[model samples]
Target chain A: MWKALLYKEWIKTRWYLLLALLVTLGFAGYALLKLHRAVALMGAGHIWEVMVTRQAVFIDQMQYVPLLAGLALAAVQYLPEMHRKCLKLTLHLPVPALATLGVMLAFGVAVLAVLFGLGIALLAAGARPVLAPELVGNILHAALPWYLAGVAGYLLGAWTILEPTWKRRILCLLMSVLLLRLFFLAPVPRAYGGFLAVLALLSLCAASLSWLSVVRFMAGRQD
Target chain B: MTRFAKLFFWFLVLVLLLWQLPWAVNYLLVQSRNTPFTLYSEVLDDFVMIRHTSDKEVEYRDRAGNEYTRRAFDSLLPLFYARQLTADGRFPDSVAGRPVTLREAQIASFIFRSAPKDLNRPAPGLHFLLESMSGRVDLAMPSDAFRLTGRGIEFIDMAANRIDTAKSGRFTRMLLRKGCRFPVRELSGNPSARKEYDEGYLLLDADGGLFHLKMMQGRPYVRAVELPEGLRLRHLFLTEFRSRRTLAFLTDESHRLHVLTMPGYGIRRVEGVTFDPERESMTIVGTLLDWTVCVDGASAERYYAVSADDFSLLDTLSYPLSERRIPGLSFTSSSDRYVKPRFR
Candidate 1:
């Protein structure tokens, strides 16, 4: 039953996921290309010095790509369901309603993980030749929170889309904006540090928020 | 599942409210406190303050409520405004009954500032060790950087992204021979070529021992600085002032400020001054005569005048901060770089 639900979501969002993959990877590749071009123009030493002394992450261009990818993916996956009123039917499936929504949220989260993981791996592999391990670690640490925000963005996007009433959806949207604001609060590299784990947990807990929307939808709540 | 979801939803709402409401109120209600620019004047034996009046005009006064004209103010702080006095042909031939020159006054002056945000942030583990005796008219950045490990130090060539084992082993051996422990707890250095000179870095090791490590002519110049008994240092600021009289400013675990003097790395406690480098911001404007140390604390901005020779307290003044703040949840702080839930 879980596989069937997962397959349905995949079939619905496969094409969008492919575009997301290309767009995200393209942004990551462009950022790395810029870093390499910098190295080629003005030796690797300059790049290393800037990264060390000035906290230059080099991949700053890709900071918002993951966020947009997550938001777009959530819209592609859930907007159709909510628009066609298919969520009501999906909830009435043999499987439990909460379990059904859980599977859908899990699928979005998993695909986002794979997409963001590939972007991070590309950055690491491309940066390895020119940067030392410490510089590479700095870039990764700086990018970690942005990638976490992608996960939080997806979950909150789903919560907002799946919400039944227009007024309630606006409230959820406000809350989501404030919550996502947490991820980009500090501009310093690796500023999230240990707090990143808490952010990841909060992103996961955001999964439950969609269930509240589903409960309201089941209760026939409307504007 | 629905019950749990509802509970979690309300928890997030409460968190958002606590974080946002106080922030909004503070943004709307709080006004920034404009602390006057102040300095100790040896001529007056009191702090001279330059502040803006309600009419936006500049006012110069001392703690004794005596105000002075702008030219009189310039004469009061001659060391600070030496150029203005010299240009006006009113420069004193001697100050405090000692022969002085414009160049002498300029070279003897330095300003040192440290804020909690600087000390509270993440350190990029890697450090540059420039050649201190390269015989060049202008210093250059090194081609490699080093990191401290459990066993010793490793220098990585920046261009090749490879460890230079030969250079690494040389410095590591010298550090080990100096009785330095592995995995330094705290390290401070001024590596810029713009500085007049380089003193490399001061390292606090795992065993609470202090070591000075620098590069000279492509070789290691490591010295194990002996600390006073039970003196556990917490932070270090390597000062490369033009005076060349002081090496570094240190703060101990008990929040007392200490100065490590040059020629002999003698550590002397700056009497009657306590600066917690993790919470407050401090600035020291020093001259040949005395230092005006200003420590901005939570509730007050305290100033101390200490003798430049012995760092003994000469006088003290403070202005209480009156700006009100609404306490609530804050994820980021002006004093730190990290994002964590904090309530004050």
Candidate 2:
């Protein structure tokens, strides 16, 4: 059921997804030009030259700066629809709320992953020989936090607009900010417990909002 | 809070935590080094003499099992040894009516603890010269680098002027081993004959009294000797002062800048130059190689020192090849990159 909902979300937003990709590619072009000039300035023997590669895929991945672009798109589109009752029409169908929410989140995450994969491929191509072994570990560690912030920010923005009461919206906003503060203070960059907690909450909200959207849609249909 | 709110909250925290991991690692490293070290005095001498003692048959171990080799001044210049003044004005081996020669001719020294603080931790030993003075201070003043001659444990003038030291003034009297000690008339034609001659460090008063130091212990010309047992190594501190032209930093790249003193080697917290608020500029007068620089009051930084008359760089030759700036520059002097220290 979640698969169907995930597909449904994709069908509605696929064009936006394409737009996001193009925007990323354009950003990559700009980054590539900058890298070329920087490399030229550093000359052939500069240590930072490894960061700039000529491979097409590598250039393409520069468009992907973790999840910043993804969240921006989602915030402008998904949150408003659910908060304003547009999601009700879809949730009324025979779908497990949790499954549907999971698919939607995965769909978002997968799109983000594609963006990231392209960048890693390019960076790998650039670092042909003298790649530091620790780079992989650091990049892996970095992804956890990037994904969390991107998805969480989008969801929060959507939920705030959907909620009827101003207090709940304010509370949600404050909570997100508070959580961000605590994370910075924590010892580990990637705390598994924290990730799980965030995932559970985001999934739960998606379910609740889907139900609300479905109920409102049905009421409109009867009228 | 609703499910969406919870997710948003947690995600925010995770992102912030990732940014903070690197900071924790740095703090841990500094704390560890502090365990075996503490700041005692702001000590800096003109030159640090070093001699390697690893080849010796018997090596002393500190409480820490760290294996450290010893170092000492290569110079064999006779050092002045002063005796504390009694009512009779005499101490140690002395001729009647003559100054007491309490200090012996020293060849090597270790200022810090020669002994390991712990048995398990093997510490590397530094062979800078220093020993106890019987109420009188010791001065290891080598006339020039090549000659390696000095007066050991000469005397201490407690009221040292942080301002002017090159000129002569009445320093408190401690018995100076007066003898046929020659003012080094000629340095070795051997290039860096002076540099190769490791001079002991000294703390001097405005009146030329000396105190607070480290020197190697040995005969005036001996090549090696037994490393001292459990010598106390003091932590060198970094100091700040204003300068007109560039001040030479430590030549030992293997070592870092630990202290900068005004008119001496270390930097005390004291500001070395003063300025009038109305002038809106500053200049430091030099009794030695440095010129008074134009600056904003007292500052310790790297500036392109231009000659006020011609605006040409005054001390460009002293920088070593491939060196541009000193890290955490506290005090600097004319460089040694091209020209070696005249005193060295």
Candidate 3:
């Protein structure tokens, strides 16, 4: 039953997941290629010095790509289910309704984790050879908050999309905006070091919020 | 599941309130206060203040409330207004019974400013050790940058993209020979090429010992500075001013500001002043005779006039500032680099 449910989610999100992976990887690769151009023009040492003294992360172009991908995934995966009322049929399957919802969210999170993880690994691998450990660590740390925002954006988008009524959906959207603002309040690089753990926990905790919308749907919540 | 969802919802609401409520109130209600620009006048032996009246009229007055004409105000602060005094032919032969020339005053004049925001912000773990005796009239940035590690200093050559292990070992050995502990606690230097000269860096070692390191003739010149027993230094500012009278300005754990005199390397405490480099901003405008030090505090802007020769407190004045605002939670502050929830 869980396999069937997993298959259903994969079927729903596979094309979108592939697109997300490509877009994210494209941005990550482009950032590295830009870094390579910089290294060639201004020596690797100049790049390292700038990163150390000025805190310049060459991958700023990739900052919002993960976030857009996450939001797009949620829109692609849940908007159709909500519009077509296919979620109601999926809820009536042999599996427990809440468990089904949990599995769907889990699958989305897993796919995002893999995609985001690949992006980060590529960044680290590309940066390590040409830069010192400290500079590489700085670039990675600077990107952590943005990627976390992507995951949170996806979870929060799911919550809003699954909400059973228009009035509550508006409230959910407002709350999500506030929550997502936490991940982007930093303008300084590595400003989110100590707070990253708590932010990631909160992003994962946001998964539970989707279940509330599901329960509201089951209770026939409406405007 | 219902209980958890309810709790989560309330938690979210609480976080929003904590982050936004005070911000909105402060944004709507806060009015920042402006204090009169005040400077100590050595000739008048009083503080000269340029104040803006409610009607927006500018008035210059001494602490005794005696109004002064713009020309008179310039005469009172002759050292600060040297060019104006010379041009007016009112340049005095002496101030406070001490004969001082315009050239002398100009050479002795210096301004040093340190703000908590600069100290508390993020710093890249790299430093340029400019050559102190480059044999050139003007200082220039070094070709390599250095980072202090647990064991020793590592210098990275910019063009070569490799560590200069030989030069690094030489400096590291010099520092170690001077009894500097492996990892330094804090280091300060004016590394810009625009400076008049380089004094390298003032480093506080792990064991709280202070050492001055500079490069002269492409070699390390390390000097172990003797701190007064039990004097725990907290912060340091390398002052490479034109005056060349002081090497650096420092604050200790007790928040007392000290001046590190040049050549001799002795420290003199600027008495009767407490400045926390983590919270307040301080500016010292100095002439040969006196230094007018202003420390901007939470509730007041305090001014201290100190004798430049000895750093003895000559006079002190403070004005109460009323900055009305709603206080609440903030994540980032003007005085710090980290983004963590804080209440003001």
Chain B TM-score in each of the candidates: 0.98, 0.18, 0.95
C-alpha displacement of B85 in model 2, angstroms? 34
Model 3 accuracy (lDDT, Cα): 0.87
Best by lDDT: 1
Task: Report the Cα RMSD per candidate.
Answer: 1.2, 25.1, 2.1
Leading candidate by TM-score? 1
Q: Could you report the DockQ of all the candidates, in the order they appear? A: 0.83, 0.01, 0.47
Tell me the TM-score of each prediction against the true structure: 0.98, 0.35, 0.94
For residues A145-175, write the lDDT of model 2, one tens digit per residue: 4444545555544444444455655765665
Candidate 2 residue runs with Cα over 4 Å from true position: A25-29, A44-67, A127-148, A177-223, B1-344
Q: Over the stretch B1-344, how does candidate 2's per-residue lDDT look in tens digits?
A: 23553464455445334433433443344331111111111011121122224473433222223233322111111121122222224332432223324232111111211111111111111112222122334333222111112432222111120212221111111212212122221111111111223333333222222233222342221111111243211222111112212112111122211123334433221122222222222223221212223233222212222222232344311112232222221111222111111121
Candidate achieving higher lDDT, 1 or 2: 1
lDDT of 1 by residue, B291-340 (tens): 99999999999999998989999999999998788999999999988888
**Which of the two candidates, 2 or 3, achieves a greater TM-score against the reference?**
3
Question: Which runs in model 1 stand beyond 4 Å of their true positions?
Answer: none
Between 1 and 3, whose lDDT is larger?
A: 1
Model 3, B182-226: lDDT tens per residue?
799999987777777788999999988989999999999999999
**lDDT tens string, model 1, A31-136?**
8899999999999878988998898998888888888899998999999998898988899999988789889999999999999999999989999999988888
Model 2 scores a C-alpha lDDT of 0.33
